[model samples]
Target: NQTKMFDEKKLDINDEKYSSFGAVLTDDNNFYFTSARNTARKTYGANEQPYLDMYMATYNADGSFSEPTPISDINTKWHDGPAAVTADGNTMYFSGESFKESKQFERDKDNNLKLGQIYLFKATKTDGKWGNIQPLPLNDKTYSTGNPAISADGKTLYFVSNRPGGQGGNDIWKVEVKGNNTYGEPQNLGDKVNTPGNDNFPYLTTEGKLYFSSDGRKGFGALDIFVIDLAKGTEAKNVGLPVNSGQDDFAFSFNDSKEIGFFSSNRTGVDQLYSATPICGVEAIVMVRDANTGKPLASAKVAILDERNNVIETRTADTNGKVTYSVDCDRAYTIQASMSGYENNSFPIAKTHGGEVNVMADLRPIVEIVKEIEVVLNDIFFEFDKSNITKEAAFELDKLVEAMNNNPEMVIMVKAHTDNRGSAQYNMNLSNKRAKATVQYVISKGIA
Candidate 1:
């Protein structure tokens, strides 16, 4: 997995009362998200939903956010924000289509002036109100710059922009966040993180890992969340499901104090918020196949066994001959696969040390063809004139029992011959006893 699975929980859960799309949890017990639920706001012509407004709520101790209230001072007639509050929770940077005095209105592609062309706006929080808002210097009439994410130290600012010198549509760009609201020159994030597709909503973590959404790279859906570790390298890896769905999933952020994460997805038909936590366990993908033919054995039952060799659970293989088991890390386990007409096979899985891994089980087919017409058996020897079956003679008798079981309709003739040292009557009597003992032995082995 380029990314691990997220133990996700949907906060909205089919309650589409609002269309919320981003999450920003701050150290000051503040939670921020963008939504179009405010009926008082004017509707934008693009989606016909109420204009997006910045909403603030309390991050509860129970890992739930309080009822969100729009930041009325910051919310304007046009779209307000999907914001990033700094580590100190004092300075905030957000994408807004509202600032009126910042150069009137922005022009569209047809040179039409409208309430579009989002730009990064910096705001300061004091006494529970957001004010002193000013657009970043990088915003221009020729291009659009928005979706701001700042580093923990507030020195670097990462954002999405279709501004000049980009890979194509929207590329992630970063700038230095100097003191006094002044900034450094913006630079593109290069082709590695920025693809020709639409990449937006960048979220920076304290560990220098940047989580963002993009349609440029191959993903489960249109906009899938991806992360790139600045310390590791710049290969933006997709954060696999259930954080990523086959629909739009974006704007991933973490709350380090609570050890919880949050993201937004339209997988429920409407954009909604989802809380995510890292799944801590091992994922074993068991692939069943034929031992000789190397073909997938679908419908095969795969069982996970504990250390005591008792089956914990069993799962049937899908069309791809694959089934997965979630087990504890650094633990030994056994997997057994079985299918009709194929011998059951079991394989020991070594300790995974906590990661996703692939395991294989090959089943040999049980050949049922009987090619022999006449069944033959070697002579069975016994101790001197004894009626009891000896260990050596029992070995040959077991083969006869197996043959009788293999061919249920075939009958066996027991002819126990002995030496000429005894009388004819005594030899006959001895042979009868030996034959009876052999028959009893076969019956003891549950053979009819």
Candidate 2:
């Protein structure tokens, strides 16, 4: 469940401060993200970073990008940017604040605290430049509304705000975009999607799935990306792993097909934009257990071998006797498992495009074969005249080794029958050498 389900690529547009992430794959090929790398701008007291400015660059298909340029027309000295462009790319809705009435900083008026609130502004691109910028009616003096996301059809606008009648904190609200650039009343998405915690950055896909960021739900960490199907009217589900982590992850945007996408996260401690591609690789999970009892064998050794039988990695299984590996797409693998007091086993994993491959290893327990303290086998007569332990004698020694393994406290004294093939002194020496050889053979098979 914690696997990286997506083939994610970090964007090069990231600065050490904040490279930003919002709308992606605009029609003009223009990229947008927030950056606070400009030391020239005064630092905001909130996060202690420089004030954010709308940065732009030319996006390439190979995940390469041109140098970022600040959108001066929409970027005020205050924090700006994180803009959403319509399907045509002619219209843009961005987050910024007006500097009118000495409101850049220090709202001195005791009752005038609205100067610092963020506003959603709409701008039109003409002759390759953004102008005719104006704030949307959703902005108010008492509350903040910004981070706008326009639906693909341009009939609905989704954004974050702390206005009245909200679920709490920052909630995602939508308004109907009527004819003539007019908007209907803003409506909260309700508790299904909105919580009493901060929820922001909504990107609605043409397929009716709304992807947004929130700290309100259960996730790996601070903020995670979630998706709720607006058509199905279900609660949001956490889009886990690679896309989310033990840090703030938000601002998810996917193309029309929801294949290629972009999202921002502070998993590295510095916020950056990451390009997400669906992982077509296969996930192989192996579980090892006892063959006879059918119970899990903990701490069993599992080795993953490639198609050529070359060992990739030898890892120990978890408490549940499970070990997982990220295998390549369309590549076959073999999972070999081994444990003490059990015979080793191996299983096969077939090639797959993008899914899980579960394999189970059932190992046979080493049964006790040695019964009596003294035993003479049928085809096993030791050559007491020589020092070399015969193959027949070694075979019986394995049974003794298995017996010692089963009863750790059992100790055996070896005795050898001698032949009068030489002098009495020579026969006595042969008997001692044969006894030593028998004990050595059993000790070699892991018997103490």
Candidate 3:
């Protein structure tokens, strides 16, 4: 199972003042982080030294990140840092301090910050552009919410808060999406995962593994990244070494395979980004086509069946008349291709390791037309009342010759027709002359 690969790089922040944290990868391989480089005055000012802000940077396919650019709309003069991106790379959820000056650190009876709230903003792609932001309903003024973590499906959100009713100082809470742009009430993750100490910065991998930073257990530093199998138990274990050094290691996200992840660390004397690569299995690709013409046919469907004929992966061909899919090559599969007007085809494929095999199966159309039949012109017409053959008459006669040559055994009687506008004897004479001319043209072309 050690087939997956991962590589890490330390993202460079060209500016000397700001530091990077909470690095997440997008489907396009771009990375997003938070920083506090040049925030001094705006809608509100920060009481702390570093007024943080979120930023985005693109990562080239060669595993390098571009210079960071501040997401100014979401960033403000107040503290804002550590963002979590959805797997699709469209939505963003992050933690930030209130940007309003009139309400600075106002606390309720429970001493929770009334203005600080965990905010969720959606970024949609319209005409290949992204810039719209909307707030989520789970944010409340009674408590301070930050350190957001979203599930791979974008249906569940997890964050840390110091509101009321928690196992410790900052307990992890979850909000499930109820419908379009709506979410249910926030619920605590319960004692199985939370401790009396602070538990925050939750990161969920595609495989359902949970990674977060906590100081509950004896660790190397103040906050250490821990992994917990939520399905089994929440007893967290440190993701040792290069990933977690003696300092704070939080804000981690993984690809679908759960083998590789990106996390931030200050062990290098600066809060930088690093990646962990684990062995991941490769997915398979398959295609189908028309055997005779080599032309792609749309609406064709393909299915992969196991030894017991149980369907495994089924997909329909896209508009390009091809279907591409990825499947773990763990077992032998019987590939089947079928369409409504074509005969079905099937072949067996043996599983192999880490290689792309093009299994293209061509299907034959069931009701096909043969190309051996010859069709001939049965009649030729005379112009008006004249008996002379016209140029157009030669054109029709030449086609008859071509048909006869295409089918050697074909024979035809060329008949000439005349409109009944003339006298019977004159009409008969004109028809006779036209038929003779047609026969002469056919014979000239070497057709019998």
Most lDDT-accurate candidate: 1
Which tens-of-lDDT digit does each residue in 1-448 have in candidate 2?
A: 5556566777767775654656466756777777887778998877888888888888776668889888887777777878888888888888887553234334648887545677888899899899988778777756788998888888899989999999999999999988455799999999988899999999987778899998989988799899898886866888788788899989988775436788988877788889888767787878898987889999989988888767899999899999888888888888878777765656888878765677889876755233456432333466435778764456445545655677787778877767667888888887888788888888788887
Choose the strongest candidate by TM-score.
1
Cα lDDT tens digits, model 3, 273-373, are 66776433334455677889877767788877777667777788876667654556466677777665565667677776533456776766644321334
In model 3, the runs with Cα more than 4 Å from the true position are 1-9, 13-17, 39-50, 100-125, 128-132, 257-259, 268-270, 279-448
lDDT per residue, candidate 1, 44-150, as tens digits?
67778898888888887877677788888788887888999889898889888735555645556586656447788899989977899888787776667888998
Order the candidate numbers by TM-score, best to worst.
1, 2, 3
Clash numbers, per candidate: 0, 0, 5
lDDT of 3: 0.67
**RMSD (CA, Å), each prediction:** 12.3, 12.0, 19.4
> Would you list the rank order by lDDT, best first?
1, 2, 3
Query: What's the C-alpha lDDT at position 83 in model 1?
Result: 94
Against the true structure, candidate 1 has what lDDT?
0.81
- Give the clashing residue pairs of candidate 1, or none: none
Model 3 / residue 381 / CA error / Å: 95
